[model samples]
Target: GKVPILLPPLPEQKKIAQILSTWDQAITATERLLENSQQRKKGLMQLLLTGKKRLPGFEGEWETRKLKELCAIKTGKKDVNEGNPDGKYPFFTCASEPTGSDEYSYDCEALLIAGNGIIGKTHYFKGKFEAYQRTYILSDFSNAVSVSYLHQFILYWLMRDIDREKQHGAMPYIKLGLLQRFNVFVPSIEEQQRIAMVLSYADQEIDGLEFKLNLLKQEKKALMQQLLTGKRRVNVETEAA
Candidate 1:
């Protein structure tokens, strides 16, 4: 069987190719930026968690602590309907985003761990926030060996352990008891704050770049759709006969 190949005129084809090439370049640049961010974050985690890299204003030997030894974990109250209109508290759920409640649940700074479904996801919350049943809220900062240090340590440790224990099934589950047994390496409070600040700054930059890249891609897509459909023609035109 013979296959027929249809080709556009040279000029039109070149214009199409040039537009696609621009998209390719944008995609490649975005991918490189994403890869760089991931690599940098991984490197920072390795160094900061292990005490290989020391931040400014901190000098202390890192310590090991069981997760349960440092913080008190509280299951979130399942009271979404109790949200008060004049309340000023942020409501949290198993997912990272805030819920539609203004009532405060936990009254202090703490780390929130997802208790079911996509388990082991952690978020640091300050002041007060209402938490749902699927989340475990950590409290008792004074009792913690070092609150800031423990927070970072637990985050890294939780992610590692959860990835390891996740079963090959439809859903991943991390039992609260199992999670509390996870081990962690902790530095002094000062070191913890320093490491968190540095990594957080990097994360902010990466997020900003991602937002800009998304906007650019959206603009490029709109341009391509308009130009290809002839709704928004470019300045170039076909030569008259």
Candidate 2:
């Protein structure tokens, strides 16, 4: 059986199409801007996090330190099943977004690293939260390094570390020893904070663009619903007879 399709009058259809085209163009432009903003942030991360591009009036030698020296690392005792949607605390699993849990495990600013699935994926949170058994928590950061800075550094370097592990014939996953031995280049605390702040500003811009893109898409969808159905009529101008 063939399905019947309802179409508007030729002029009205053309007008609707034209209106939708405008929205399409806007969506495409916003998508391009979002991509460019993300690329800009990635470039900034590569330069600033590596110390190759120093911010104004900050000049000093960067020291290298092992992960163990910078913070205490441990795995969470809770499992994925422990997460509760209505719980009080954020329950972190290997996934990107945290679920909820009533119980509190750790209370500090730390980096949550996915140990297995989505390996090397990291989340930075500065409050009380629970974690999955496979989630590695790095807390009690040394005064020499800012936890925010370390979070940014790990995000920049973690992928490379994973690739290196693959090159060494090991499975792609975060091990306790890997965290203990990973090397981080340390700049002064003040410089670290400055770099993190700049990168964060870049993040905020990207987020705002994303929110705009979503809104544009949603608006376009609503327009399509109205125009395609008989719910809303289009005004198509006619030529003089």
Candidate 3:
């Protein structure tokens, strides 16, 4: 049996629905904007990583290298109990949980790749943080061929290869050896920075927009609950017949 909708009188129902419809329209518009931005970001990544799009003041061919050639995979400490209450360090795990400790493990900016169950997930850690054993830290960026460029490159490569490597009956895992053999497209440092910056900006904007949309949705939901329940009513004067 279909649940009956406790709609108000015809005119009031129309008004309530109209208000909700306006909110829906705003949500739809915001969602479309987010999608467009994401699509553009993807396009930028394709062009920038492939060297087809060159940012102003940058000129050079990109170099190619394997993951091991550019970074040393450092595993995090395994002591979960080592978390300190007074410690002031950020903790990271394969699941992106910040629930470990406040101690510095690797003191530098490098890309962190999930090495075990949630393999190939990449995070750029720029501050002091404690990382879980299941996570692998990338260090030695300064001496590498192109650290920043390779950082983004590995992300793109992982995005492409992760699903293909996930086999049924076997847990998804990214072996360090496999990462070592993974090919990377390295652009000049300047170009690499440019591309990373552009993509990062897009991501930030998307996050901000999503946050705003969520807030707006919550507000709309609250309004609907109150208005639909007859707890709040809009004033509508009727003329004498």
Candidate 4:
């Protein structure tokens, strides 16, 4: 148990509580919207990536193929120290921020899939980049499947697997062979591009909503700092001259 805390006088307490309540309500609403948008994106990925829902004008059965048949896979060459802080290329690692590097092992559209820590997380990138040894870089997709479509579909598949079976042991790890042998249902190039385009637009909407949520949170933080410290006052309507 803990000791009870002191409180401000009645009027000031009521005013502060009222003002903070409005902000709390706003934050809750924004969070709900964000949750709904995220769920919608997941639903879209499940449908589009699995070929359960086809875009208009799309006909013919989707071909099922292993990942190795579609793209080339490889691990990175550069060590941790080899990465540069102020370099032109992206050096991906298991960490949150991608390291920078002057040199690159691959220079084309690729998916950087975390093979060790934060395993199954994937990043889609086009252009020159470097990767950590444990990270798997997949590129050079075939004409049957667009790179963008494959990237999204693979990520969706990984998400499903990771969600069901969380970790392998103490650390989650993905093997190159597992990634290579992964099976996927792919539509024609035209249909794949169409699905990718729709998902991309959906991503844009989610991004916009998330940005708004962040702004609201920042605003609320600033307000709490100002109000609680008595730096700013809540100017409630009053019967005064």
TM per model? Answer: 0.76, 0.90, 0.79, 0.86
- The 10 consecutive residues of candidate 4 with the worst lDDT sum are 232-241
Q: lDDT ranking from best to worst?
A: 2, 4, 3, 1
Clashing pairs in 2: none
Error of 1 at 164 (Å): 0.7
Query: Judged by TM-score relative to the true structure, which candidate is superior, 1 or 3?
Result: 3
Selected candidate, larger TM-score, 2 vs 3: 2
On the 0 to 100 scale, the lDDT of residue 152 in model 2 is: 85
lDDT of 4: 0.81
Q: Which stretches of candidate 4 lie over 4 Å from their true place?
A: 1-9, 81-88, 167-171, 238-241
1-241 per-residue lDDT for model 1 (tens digits): 5866444556765676577678779877987887799778778877888888788777877777767777776688865456553557767666555555666656788888777745777777788678877778888754435565566666676777676666445236556777577676677666667777777777787887788688878878877776665565443375211
Best by TM-score: 2
lDDT of 3 by residue, 1-241 (tens): 7977776788777777777888899989988988888887778778887888888998866677877777777778855567764668766666644554656766888787777645677777787788777777888764545555666677776766776656443446666677778877776666677788887897888888888789879988998888888898765445111
Number of backbone collisions per candidate, in order? 0, 0, 0, 0
lDDT of 2: 0.89
Whole-model lDDT, model 1: 0.70
User: Given candidate 3, what's the lDDT at residue 148?
Assistant: 58
Angstrom error at residue 29, model 3: 1.6
lDDT of 1 at 126: 81
Deviation (Å) of 216 in candidate 4: 1.2
Our tally of clashes for model 1 stands at 0
Candidate 3 vs 4: which has more lDDT: 4
In model 1, which runs have C-alpha deviations exceeding 4 angstroms? 1-17, 55-60, 79-90, 102-104, 143-148, 167-171, 237-241
lDDT of 1 at 96: 53
